[model samples]
Target: MANNIFEKSITDSLINRVNQLTPTTPNQWGKMNVAQMLAHCNVTYEMTYENKHPKPNAFVKFMLKLFAKSTVVGSKPYKKNGQTAPQFIVKDAKDFGVEKERLVQYLKKTQELGEKHFHNRESHSFGRLTKEEWSAMFHKHLEHHLRQFGV
Candidate 1:
């Protein structure tokens, strides 16, 4: 079975990865600085948990469903320095500590909610997803960025 966010072990691993990051940490690749990276990472969960960003219109959502759904929910890992969604881009500087703490909280909350909680959850862009899809979207994204920073 694939490692997933619903598993406590996987969640711990992700937390550890985040913990390894510091304000001074430099990216192995990608344009965002450490603070921006952390903020960028939080955007995923924010999309899931908060309504901070507006949902894509029907046409845009359909486009994302066709073009981006597979990359996000598939088992295949993300390529380094891939293009980010407009909402995911962190344009300004962020506070590393604040972003890190928020991300950790989001991870823990998701883990506590568990796979059953995520089954058929409505995604911000790609519509409804199964627990596995949710896990893949959450885990792979964090893993990709963490790996990008050489954590």
Candidate 2:
């Protein structure tokens, strides 16, 4: 089984990884600075919790479902300097502390909600996903970015 957000210990370990990040930390790969990377990571949670970004049109969603779903929800770690979805691109600078705090809060919230709450939840682009898929999506993303900045 995958490392799941429903498990408090897993969530705690994720939180610890985020806490290890500092403002001046340099990226080992990618164009985004640490702060921008944090903000980019938060985009996923924002898509779930906030209505800031418009949902993809049906065709685009279908395309995402067909092509991007496995890359996201599967166990494979993202490649260094991998292409980001348009919505996730953080162009401007970000406050490291602010983004970090927001991500940690989001992680806590997801963990508190538990896996059952997210089971078969409809994703903005990928449609409904099992709890395992959700966990893989969330955990793999954070772990990828955290490792990118050497956190």
Candidate 3:
């Protein structure tokens, strides 16, 4: 979004935008509450860090390659009501404070590690990523969800 995509200033600004949202704020698009949206955002980093979720099978991987990869790593922004990972679909509301703090911690951890640390990082599903691709995936996904919740 900004010239310095991975700079603390940009990440901090996104955090601020997330903090600006309240529980009562209506979504400009999408079904998730603000807290759920934050949790949804955290899933990307969780996928990168934690090994809790299983990797997709060959067929599923092929499908993601053909359909999901472009939307995830490409320059175009995600549409407001587009498809989401099954684990990310929180039907009920979430505790706002918990989700917010967790996401902030994830962001801080990621930034502290920086690009080179992630340049050859093994992704749970995608194998490995270049620093720039990691930056694109992180920034674009967060921007998409933040815009959805009107933050």
TM-score of each: 0.97, 0.98, 0.89
Better of 2 and 3 by TM-score: 2
Report lDDT (Cα) of residue 59, candidate 3.
84
Error of 2 at 142 (Å): 0.5
Off by over 4 Å in 3: 1-5
TM-score of 3: 0.89
Cα lDDT listed for each candidate: 0.93, 0.92, 0.78
Candidate closest to the true structure, highest lDDT: 1
- Candidates 1 and 3 compared: the better one by TM-score is 1
Candidate 1 per-residue lDDT, tens place, 58-146, comes to: 99999999999999999999998788898898879898999999999999999999999999989999999999999999999999999
RMSD of each: 0.8, 0.7, 1.9
Task: Please give the distance, in angstroms, between residue 135's alpha carbon in candidate 3 and its true position after superposition.
Answer: 1.0
**Model 1's lDDT to the true fold?**
0.93
> What is the Cα-based lDDT of residue 24 in candidate 2?
88
Candidate 2 CA-lDDT value: 0.92
